[model samples]
Target: MMHSFGELVTKFTSYFNVRHFPMAPSTLYDPCEYFLGLGGKRIRPVMCLMGNELFDKITPDAYHVANAIELFHNFTLIHDDIMDKAPLRRGMQTVHTKFDEPTALLSGDVMMIQAYEYINKVRTNTIHRILTLFNKTAAQVCEGQQLDMDFEKKETVDLDDYIEMIGLKTSVLMAASLQLGAILGGAGDSNAKHLYEFGLNLGIAFQVQDDYLDAFGDPEKFGKQVGGDIVANKKTFLLIHALDVATGAQKEELQNLLKQNEDDKVEKVLAIYRSCGVDEWARSLKEKYVTVAFQHLEDIAVLSVRKKPLKELTSFLVQRDF
Candidate 1:
């Protein structure tokens, strides 16, 4: 029943394709194409268009702006892969790992520039507003990434701090995506602001869900290594919960699990996490965020018909497997 939002995005992307590269381009173009071609949920752009449609019709004008969001997101991914030293993106070779770090860096930079170029396709006034939003979101994303990296070295990251970090690192772009869509579709300032809040809340919930999935999800349905966050020593909800709840030997065991280098490290960590009830704690946290997200959606004040597709899209996003 059209479970994949990327299917809609794939159908729409052909129209956004533009030819701007100089002849016989370097390897930079290859990484751009490689990462972009390896499809994703396209939740951001779809929300953009849906936001636009809430105020006006979806047309070519909307596609350019929506596509810019996609470009900007991919730009972030390429740089993030390098920063994370991640070997795979969407289950395939990462740009930095497949090519080289230098190539990936240059390609990521080009993608950022290309994102601007895509935004410029809109008219002059829209370009000004869109670029302003894009610039702010890009900078904030970098800030968020830095915070995430910093948290890795830290021992006491609170829930509030983590939320703020995700807000900058992940949620702002989503807010911008919806605002851009609303702006493109001729929404009033109030409506645009509300749509942005909706996107922000949804983004937070989606990220929290990712954390829950890392520790509690069925691997067959989730389509990745379970307890991956634990294995990588990533600070996720499960880890955070354990930090808050475990005491004495349990704390020591968790700490030891975090430090251990073994073949079944993830399995061992999950066993401990389950025994400590971190899984249930994390699940409750995920649900809390999801409830808040839907509350924001309800407060959007748009007509129900206008909001239906957007709500459907958001439901598909947070409920999806992997």
Candidate 2:
């Protein structure tokens, strides 16, 4: 039976709500539970379930796979919070802040190890491939994070370099989630590859939209600090593309804005972004990647009807405020 992304989200949330850790070390397990309770959209795991249902009936194994994917995703978030020194996540205290860094680290470690245990529960014939993909994607995510940190120290980051970082940091895990689910659903190698490509492109588009929203969306609707990226001087689609296409005084003005720590910095930078048409470019870039993603989804050898949920999911992701 096929399921829309929303249906799969409800199904996955039930399984994900359980305590996956032991009760003993409250310092460790309590933080894990608290962070899990923060309750994200469950996008990655639900994508996994949707991938599975697209090819065959939903399997118990798919839930296990989804559990592992989500646990790992949250584990990354814990570490990301620590690295960013983020005090809040989902509008609550971050794991490191509420508990302590050491305890949060241990909690994240347990979550990651438990993710592997969930993976071990899957009885798919493609188990080895699943293990390999999971491990590789995990490392790529770390590599992307490292690159992002590295870029922060540099003066100028190439637009291409920035793209590579987001693809590694943001896109690979999402790509692997779909491929892993597809493999479990009896997808042949070619079809699985197409699905992976679909996810990779979709993830890039998602990041582009996220970066755009951080700069331009309503702080109330977007639920994030507007111009947060500019404040951090983070490398993003708009800033990087503005650097690439801007010229002479506009280019010089942007570089100076990047160096300034002032109340007017966001407005000044956004002025340049509008002048250079970076915001419009970001929308087009997001759509470009989403279009490519759906084309790959089309290449998957499933009945056309089976493709609807994925198409809807992609549309929802890219169409959000951009």
Candidate 3:
């Protein structure tokens, strides 16, 4: 993954940086540089490049599209961190935390605009299709974030709602990113749809795998604090599974813990989840979704050799520990 992406990152980072000027230091430019400089895995853009390469030769213009996705993703992250009141991201200070809330918000807006500028350079014929998908996806992502916040306030969330939330929040962008690449690469509508479905399924499985890692991953490999989800009373798969399988007292205990104020939140919720076999249930769900994702990828109707990297990407994602 890093092979092509390292060059793209260096190229685009320079491009974005040059667009920022030698104007004297101020609150305005700081957030832009801060968040961009903080850096991340740059996974979304790389996925875009890889998706394009699945059909056509790698193009420098593909880097622009990929950069657009990266900017948009980082924009979402800035806003999300603000909403989550998260202090850290990518193991560094969050944009909102490092600067102020207002700066973070403005910077995020600027990033979104910058993304549009990059996307505008896509071929004129494909621009309409690309923007249509991008706009719908951006809207869906906001809707997903709203649903996640709504989940925090809800007493009970159904499984369907949970699945839909993840689909919109995480999966849609992955689908869009791949679809954009395919669209630009001259793929027909049928192939684009297939690739989009492949990405969506992979994304759902990825989220499920993340949930499993929260409970079962090796700490060193997983990074950050394990069981952080339990501490927050976030309605992950484990919690939902425990809600269904837990006996009367177990359900009561879990609910009581959610309602309680204690430092042992992680320990208590994890104990309840273990008793209900919620971890195992979550692992099974993850595997099921991963299998479904792979099946979708396999059925894409592309030549086997052309599909190999995508399959490898899926394998790495579903089986990842960190």
RMSD of each: 2.7, 1.3, 2.7
Model 1 clashes, total count? 0
lDDT of each: 0.78, 0.89, 0.80
Clashing pairs in 2: none
TM-score of each: 0.91, 0.97, 0.91
- Per-residue lDDT, model 2, residue 19, is 85
Worst 10 residues of 1 by lDDT: 1-10
lDDT (Cα, tens digit) per residue for candidate 3, span 6-69:
5544554565554432233557667876788876766677678767877787666677788889
TM-score of 3: 0.91
Whole-model alpha-carbon lDDT for candidate 1? 0.78
Candidate 1 error regions (>4 Å): 1-10, 16-23
- In model 1, the Cα lDDT at residue 118 comes to 73
Worst 10 residues of 2 by lDDT: 313-322
Best by lDDT: 2
- Residue 317 CA error for candidate 1 (Å)? 2.0
